[model samples]
Target: MTTTRLPLFPLNTVLFPGLVLPLNVFEPRYRALMADLLELPEDGPRPFGVVAIRDGHEVAPSAVGLPETGKPPELAAGSGFARDDPRRSFHEVGCVADASTIRERPDEEGYEVLATGTTRFRLVSVTAEGPYLTAEVEPLEEVAGEGAGALASGVLRAFRSYQKVLAGANERSLAPGQDLPDDPSVVSYLVAAATMLYTPDKQRLLQAKDTATRLAEELRILRQETAVIGKLPSVPGAEFTVRPTSLN
Candidate 1:
């Protein structure tokens, strides 16, 4: 478990490794994050950590000057500047993402970044003394064991069945299957990214310490969702598009 200080991007949604996250770099702080990453050597990979915000605002809270229960006055009464320049509290686990494409926005406000999730990490500490969040992160890996292969196979089977339930693929329907990896770690993240599960559920899967646990959680979620849809037939989030960044 190697630790490094990397720029952090906190969002409202969870990101899984091996998934793609498209982001609009509109906010000032996040725009700063983009700039910082840009200054890194482009010869190799330039990446940042993205963690899900558990509370507070993605952008600064609207009523900024007011002091929270234990916060300092400069953040509240001391600063005449209205915007406290704060970041939200985020989940402990995050994914390191490498930018695949970057372009200037049409209006020229900020950049549009397409980041591909590379791996998961556990955020150790957040250094918010800068323009954007920077964090000390320890990289996380799948603790696969002898049983992980069996778990992966079961998860793959369950995921296919769940997809079929969602597609409503009747006897005549010749729909193809989603392309998923055979490796347990890759399979866990890929299916979690593809599924439209709730944010907490996704977070739970992300926080799972090993491939076996993550795969089991995915299977449980798949079965639960499939059962719900089977009875109700018109569940609200039956389908979802891959979400864009909440750059705020």
Candidate 2:
């Protein structure tokens, strides 16, 4: 029920709780974000809101030398930059992430950050008055809804079956030897992250109302995907790897 302010980072991918995100931050705006996180108290958690981009590019066009008019040249021409409504560029529901490690590249181009998703939040408002986007968000509760434990068990079995099918099709392990967690919420998120679903599908999983809801949906998805993969002649290569907000 409580609301909090967080720096916002919009990317093309969706993040789920307990999933680790590795970011290659080279954009000026995001590089600034990394610098701010590096300045946080070493012992305290450095958190940010990571929302998926609804439209437009994650890397913005250079706005330098453009007149400070009502719209930037790209906005006026409709071809130079992203959408004018910054708020519309990103999804409203997102995950909260904690930066565990931030290392500066040798060339100082940007930072290589390792972060893990922690929780979910609904965006209330976004502001661009600073170097990067920031938002006021209401935290989403991690409720273990009715029959979550049973649903979790079903999901795990379905996921194992999915992994086998996917491996046969793709000839690769998603993450071999990774011990799957047992807590319902953890299981829900872990499956959501590890699954090879599209970004929209993953976002839907992240936005599920509770653990049981997510598990139920995942159970259906796993079965559906496994069946489809089992029928496939061969699977194409996919980018399986799966980013932070602003600072003043």
Candidate 3:
């Protein structure tokens, strides 16, 4: 596998390849991370890694979603170095992302970073303790296997059922008619992103070594969640959530 040095961003969330991540960049350390990233050659993709904070803080007072997600409670918490807390550190596996746009925050106090997921990587070693974390990482991919046949179709059906149950449980979701990607790897990552799962659970999916194995896990999780939803009493006026579903 190929390896490269990547600047790191630790957050309270999990990111999946082919998904978009919007971040509130306010701390001085991360501000430096953003600046260094901007200096990279624009001729090719400039990507950074995002690893879930297993025990530490995001190192920024702000961890806002896009304007639509509203402000989460964590945004209001304290900001500091991620490693200041004795128990804080990042997970070893993470996704690399390419920033599509970086704009100054409306208040002009910080910046908003909008990035699309590019690839996944596993940390080989830490090269920088911080201004922000940096590390050597090996790129990861699903073990190449045949795709898009009966196994895939069954997985797709399970995903649909999972989404239906999830929409009923939640208040909103992506729209219909648009279909899932035929690439098994892409579908697995996309489904991992959309599913309501714990950060560790999502991380487990991220570390899966093969698309076929990931699909099996995805189908199992979807079925498990769906069955849980199946036993719940129906809401009188509940509707399937609808918005654009395609991550691409």
Indicate which candidate wins on TM-score: 2
lDDT of each: 0.69, 0.74, 0.68
Residue by residue across 219-241, what tens digits does model 2's lDDT show? Answer: 99888877776666554422222
lDDT of 3 by residue, 1-248 (tens): 68998887777778888988877776666667787877887566768887777766653344653334333223212243343442246677889999877777786556788899888888786544456667788998657455534556667788787666655345334444557887777878877887767778888888887777777887888788677666667732233322222221
TM-score for candidate 3, please give it. Answer: 0.80
lDDT of 2 at 205: 86
TM-score of each: 0.78, 0.83, 0.80
Candidate 3 achieves a global lDDT of 0.68
- In candidate 3, which residue ranges exceed 4 Å CA deviation? 65-88, 146-149, 235-248
Give the higher-lDDT candidate: 1 or 3: 1
For candidate 1, write residues 142-163 as lDDT tens digits: 6875577888898788777766
List CA RMSD, all candidates.
7.7, 7.0, 5.7
Ranking by lDDT: 2, 1, 3
Error of 3 at 188 (Å): 0.6
Candidate 3, poorest ten consecutive residues by summed lDDT: 239-248
